[model samples]
Target: MTLSFFDQFMSPVLMGIPLMFLALTLPWALFAKPSPRVLNSRMVALQTWSIMGFVKQIFQPLSTPAHKWAMILTSVMMFIITMNLLGLLPYTFTPTTQLSLNLGLAVPLWLATVILGMRNQPTHALGHLLPEGTPPLLIPLLIIIETISLFIRPLALGVRLTANLTAGHLLIQLISTAAFTLISIMPTVAFLTGLLLFLLTFLEVAVAMIQAYVFVLLLSLYLQENV
Candidate 1:
């Protein structure tokens, strides 16, 4: 049987049951729960400290009104990070690589921010469509352009995440396959390729984490503009 490179992006199935649900739920189980003890284990302590730092960094620039979204944003950050990292393991599927899944996550959050802004401060939200001191002739054109850009935000968010993860995974798979194929044909070349593959894998790990952070950071910026 011949396998296609794109096969890696497809959600797996077993006995007619899709595994995406399992992939989504498994990451929550790996999270460390806080202990009530005065001194928790080192792992829990580190996790707490890291999470606090992330929250602080994300919310620092936003007004008090935006702070209420801290929990939702934080949970999303953790979820994306976990899913991205998990997908790097052998035989694991990456849900974020799917455009549909990414769009599903991005649209509602982006729409909510937009809706919140419109509801709370309609004047300000609508004002964004027109810049101060614009020529009367350009008003219609600018408003049309701005409106299009506003709606494109969610699509851009989803595509950015899907493209990054999909590209990284595809590259890793291609390079590893090349390394394996060269092993018997040329030992020295194969060894060099293998070393390159190792480096690529490490880089992919970083990419996975960074992409997750970027996704969350952009969403927070959107929220900041709204709140």
Candidate 2:
């Protein structure tokens, strides 16, 4: 029974074929594309305005060179937000809940910033490994520590997103199970539990949006340092 609770996180399969690809593509369909005509529908207008705001905020701190990444960053942010929110609906699979998927997204973007730094300003990039005016004895230790931290960034990014979403989903499921079980035996308690569940669902919605923003914000910060 306990294992069944975790089964929701597993990629759904049909005839032995994993449907993760479908889950990944499903969220994109919900977003309305902009129209070429002069006037646009309210849905398209809202999407356009919100995306513009996010793009402006993300690029505000980044250099001109990093501005080239605006489209990619915005798309990823929207994708993650959509996936996280969609998972809250009945029978929907969240691609972001998978650590492998999160890591796949994180590693490439982090590596891109690192590579950009190295290619554009090798000296500046390497300088991040050791601080200036370091004592000779501490130089080697600091360099090793910084290097380790540098590589760990992607891992941290992946783990953070996975852990938060997984924990929230587990809690929601647990609370829901309790609510359903109590509905007959203890009507009052079940009603309160249902109320709590509703509130938790709202909080999770905010978390879904916040986590996506945080993920993109951190990536932009990394880009800022490189550019």
Candidate 3:
């Protein structure tokens, strides 16, 4: 299983999507942790009238708004961490390991910040994008970088997950593949190599939680800052 440079780049990239985790989520409620969430006016209206029960169905029977949001976000963190752990298995999909999926989670927070700021103070949201304590002379450069970075957080979110997970998966896969290939030729020597993959996978679950926590924590901080 010694791969050339080309093979090194090819294997898991072919499986960009995480199929197994998505399949496991099919009976969504089994994987879902339902809880109380507050009903905003818009959601209240939907709960009262929507045919699909889209508004309140995911929520617990007597949930408040915070309960529901808490459930939703916690479920997402679990989903990502679970998926990442699953991917570490011999053959499984890691949804959070994808750039697209991570961006899907991050971009909405960015959009929400914009909407929250605008709604709170229609004329002032854009102004809040710049640093508050900077000197007037340094204002332009600070504004440019901060604004650009603000916009790029979602992209950073995506890249951060994609890069780290992809690198870990690639390294582990390469190591295991090498061991598997040589195990027949040199049984005793490759056993340790094969075992290392499992140890690393166990370690990766922690990495998954850390990354998810970092994403959500930054999101909460950003929301607090803007809104």
TM-score for all predictions?
0.97, 0.97, 0.67
What is the clash count of model 1? 0
Better of 1 and 3 by lDDT: 1
Q: Which candidate achieves the best lDDT against the true structure?
A: 2
Model 1 has an lDDT value of 0.91
Off by over 4 Å in 2: 1-3
Over 1-227, each residue of candidate 2 has an lDDT whose tens digit, in order, gives 35788899999999999999999998899999888899999999999999999999889877799999999999999999999999999888888899999999999999999999999999999999999999999998999999999999999899999999999999999999999999999999999999999999999999999999999999998898888
Local distance difference test values of all predictions, in order: 0.91, 0.94, 0.63
Q: What would the per-residue lDDT of candidate 1 be over residues 132-214, giving only the tens digit for each residue? A: 99999999999999999999999999999999999999998988889889999998998998898899888988988888788
Model 2 lDDT, residue 45, Cα: 94
lDDT score of residue 224 within candidate 2? 86
| Candidate 3 per-residue C-alpha lDDT over 59-166 given as tens digits, one digit per residue, 9 for 90 to 100 | 334224223344455555555666666566654556666566678888986677667767876667677667578899989988888789778888987788788887
Give the C-alpha miss distance for residue 159 in model 2, angstroms.
Answer: 0.6
Candidate 2 has its poorest 10 consecutive residues by lDDT at: 1-10
TM-score of 1: 0.97
